[model samples]
Target: MATRDDGAGAWYHRGQVCCTNRKLDEALACYDKALELSPDNPLLWRRKGFALIKAGRYAEATVCFDRALAIDPDDATAWQRRGYALACMGRKEGAVACFDQALARDPEHILAWQSRGWLLGTLCRYDEAAACYETVLRIDPDRGSAAWHRERMRERRDLAALASEVREAERFMEVPACIREVVRERDYGNAELARAVLREMVGQAERPAVQHR
Candidate 1:
């Protein structure tokens, strides 16, 4: 047992080092070795899940995260990682539920909050997404990326509103007589000359209609 534990520790350390170096395959190999020695270590399982996620093996990563969560139900990191893997698998609803679980375990988990916000954005829940980002900003005022994301969400909402307003205004907009003429003459004359004529027509159109007293 002692020898097996030592091997597990060594493999875990090697896996962590490889993960830090972004060598996902090597990290996975070490994690596999560690799991062989200590199959019940939740931490090792979580590490393997993260490495699989980095390697773009999201389905396998989800299983690993689920295994870790089964071993340690209160593991907020595992929940958050599972949420990410679910999101990558296009299971948005499942991802959101996992994120909620992570937040329930640790409300101050910034990554969980961020992931929830991103999922909300994907679902087109801009208001909720903005609120989530605002919460993140409140928790970490130095989070420049969160601030930027909040601003972008606001911009998207505002642009959508502006577009609706433009559509409504278009119902009242009338093509000016000169613009109509320019369009009619465009094919028969130089485009520049047509534009010049259109500009003069606009000037005349803007002038109040002359009325003899």
Candidate 2:
């Protein structure tokens, strides 16, 4: 760690202060000065990236995150910020992948989970999105905003799951009449019945069609 006795540390501290004041440009300048003194410092690069992000220079922020990741591949926050930059650029697939990487590196990252939930919702993965919000609520129940998002997403997920079940039921009706009779007559569980039909259907599909005489 750089100490206050060093010029770079002094500049970095200045950068932090500027960032706290939302003076992003000044913060970037301070970080740039710090980087000039300590070129390989990943924290300086990451902080500069944050300033660039706040300034709406997402492309620059992305590059900064890349540099930070190169310096330390396990930097979860850098991965998360990279995802944020990609998302802001409308590159959702890349953003989601980055967020997944961030989570794989640090599952306890609440902002990463929250952001992933928002991205998953945008991608129409409502159930998965709801799961992410649910995790966020578990991590910080006192956050009313997170609680609200979780409740709404949970409702959507439940509705989606119900609709999925309805569709599966309709599909089940199209199966062999004999299979339906067995299912209706026997006290077999619905899950086992579905598995039985699936096995039969798969076996039939894998076998060659019988030739007509």
Candidate 3:
């Protein structure tokens, strides 16, 4: 029979060592043994959740985070881990909510902020996503990835606006009633010229209302 640790200290030390050695399964087992002895220890549960995540058991990791959060609702680390696990599981909304909770607890939490930005980007909230990336840049000026993401978000916004303009141009090109008779009666000397005139008219009509600054 595997004996459980009566004191949380020994189990925590062993678990940390196992984790440091990259033996995630053994680390998780040690954490489990610790939790079995002290079910109310939020830190132990949080450690277990992290080890489970390292083991690629994201859903189970989320459950362990939930257990830790239930024990101490103000645990920001648990909330952050839960958010990461949710994001890994493709639950963007849930991940956003969890990240929000983590940020509420610790406003300076960089990972939570970055995660929120990523989730916002995933949801097509480009402006908000850009804001989040900017926040990260403010905290760490050398954050190259955040800068790259911010640029991509700006490009996506510009591209979406351009695409909308193109669609509007297509809609405007539907043969106008006033031009229908003229188009039917007049034969241009060159097919290319007729197509060029039509394209010019469509472009004029579909000019986007907003100008990019």
Q: Which candidate ranks first by lDDT, i.e. highest?
A: 1
Better of 1 and 2 by lDDT: 1
lDDT of 1 by residue, 30-112 (tens): 99999999999999999999999999999999999989988999999999999999999999999999999999999989999
| Deviation of model 2 at 52, angstroms | 0.8
TM-score of each: 0.77, 0.70, 0.74
lDDT of 2 by residue, 113-186 (tens): 98898888787687788889888878887878777776666655544443444356555445555545544554
Clashes of 3: 0
Instruction: State the lDDT at 152 in candidate 2.
Output: 66
Lowest-scoring 10 consecutive residues by lDDT in candidate 1?
Answer: 182-191
Query: Candidate 3: RMSD over Cα atoms?
Result: 10.5
For candidate 2, the lDDT comes to 0.80
RMSD of each: 9.6, 9.9, 10.5
Determine which window of 10 residues in candidate 3 has minimal summed lDDT.
Answer: 182-191
Residue-pair clashes per candidate: 0, 0, 0
Lowest summed lDDT across 10 adjacent residues in model 2 is found at 182-191
| TM-score of candidate 2 versus the correct structure, residues matched by position | 0.70
Score each candidate by Cα lDDT.
0.82, 0.80, 0.79
lDDT of each residue in 34-151, candidate 3, tens digit only: 8878888899999999988888899999999999999999998899899999998998889999999998998878888888888888888888899888989999989999999887
Q: For residue 75, give model 1's deviation from the true position in Å.
A: 0.8
